[model samples]
Target: MILTEEIKRIKSTEKEARKFGIQVGLVFMIITLILFISDKGNSHYFFIVGGVLIILGQLFPQLLIIPNKLWMSLGVVLGYFSSRIILFVLFYFILTPIGIAAKIFGKNFLEKKINIEKKSYWNIRNNHYNKSQTEKQF
Candidate 1:
């Protein structure tokens, strides 16, 4: 019985992640369109809508400024269907790289990027190797 409950929980979590991904993606679309169409003719409306959407998208993954690959894909789809031509082109460029990278590296590309953690200035100055106090004395 516990196993069944665990499976249900896992599935729910996965579903929620996908939902969040989709929502963020939609926001990305709005962001590009808003930025591209800012002008006097109903452009301001698009711009505002787009801005709000982008903000929501960004807030979805708080502190993660760059939306993930899946979000980018959704954004492109949303942007392409948007009423403005300029917005479509802009979003296309923003999202194409995701497909390209995925094609080149498959699903592993998004698993985790190799991030070099920051080391202390002393460590950097001394390189990664630790210095011995006795050696310094000599």
Candidate 2:
């Protein structure tokens, strides 16, 4: 089946999300390294920032790749609270898995949806053919 605009959009967004995710991970790693090397006893603030960055890294990609509008909306709402470590972790765990699942299955899912739409349209058009044939038979 020909790729629909929506499917093309999703594929492109998924690529961008992957790149952004990699950048986030790298930045988080760098910050962690800086915190370790500095070894300041009062570095709790740095740790907090590192933790938040880690969650944001995961959350950002998940938000871009998630196919479900409801989940995407929920991700946005949850993102506001991701500075809280617990909610950050929760969002990372929940949304990341769903986003991965969407990536894996997205092409097939969209192809099926498109095929179904095409079939329905053709079925409607073919109904006229069937009726004309039957009407002439009698």
Candidate 3:
């Protein structure tokens, strides 16, 4: 029983982590799109708001696992700032390829290559239930 409960908790954590990642990616994209289309003067505001939204999206899903709201919020804030340099480096690695391609082939070509809106990131990986159901116990 204990092992089963632990497995369930682990699965839940994985689910939440996936959801949080998707949310952060979505918010980041939306904020980035708005910033890109808008004038340069409004970029500072978008950056601040985008940072806040990403942090909130990252931490909100963990609220159920974390009991103390204050500590959770504090942790989120500290995590963002403390790891920012590392995160920026990671971000560059993750996004730089796409950025370079966009510059070369143009943004529209890149968009046509990977259209997130039509692809629907959240709906793409829905094999979990089917796979679990199909698994047999010996």
Which of the numbered candidates is closest to the native, going by highest TM-score?
Answer: 2
Model 2 lDDT tens row, 60-134: 655535533333445555654564777778779997787788889774434345544353534334344466677
Candidate 3, residue 57: Cα displacement in angstroms equals 12
Candidate 3 lDDT over 2-91, as tens digits, reads 433433443335345445545655666677677778744565665666565455546665543332333345555666567887888777
**lDDT at position 127, candidate 3:** 50
Q: How many backbone clashes does candidate 1 have?
A: 0
As a whole number from 0 to 100, the lDDT of residue 60 in candidate 1 is: 53
Total clashes for model 3? 0
Put down candidate 1 lDDT per residue, 1-138, tens digits, no spaces. 543343333322333444554465566556556666663345555545555545554555432223343444555556545747776776688667777777787766454545467353232254555568557876
TM-score of each: 0.21, 0.26, 0.25
Candidate 1: residue 60 Cα off by (Å): 18
| Cα distance off (Å), candidate 3, residue 108 | 69
Model 1 lDDT on a 0 to 1 scale: 0.52
lDDT of 1 at 17: 46
Which of candidates 1 and 3 is the stronger one according to lDDT?
A: 3
Candidate 1 Cα outliers beyond 4 Å, as residue runs: 1-12, 39-138
Q: Give the alpha-carbon lDDT of every model.
A: 0.52, 0.55, 0.57
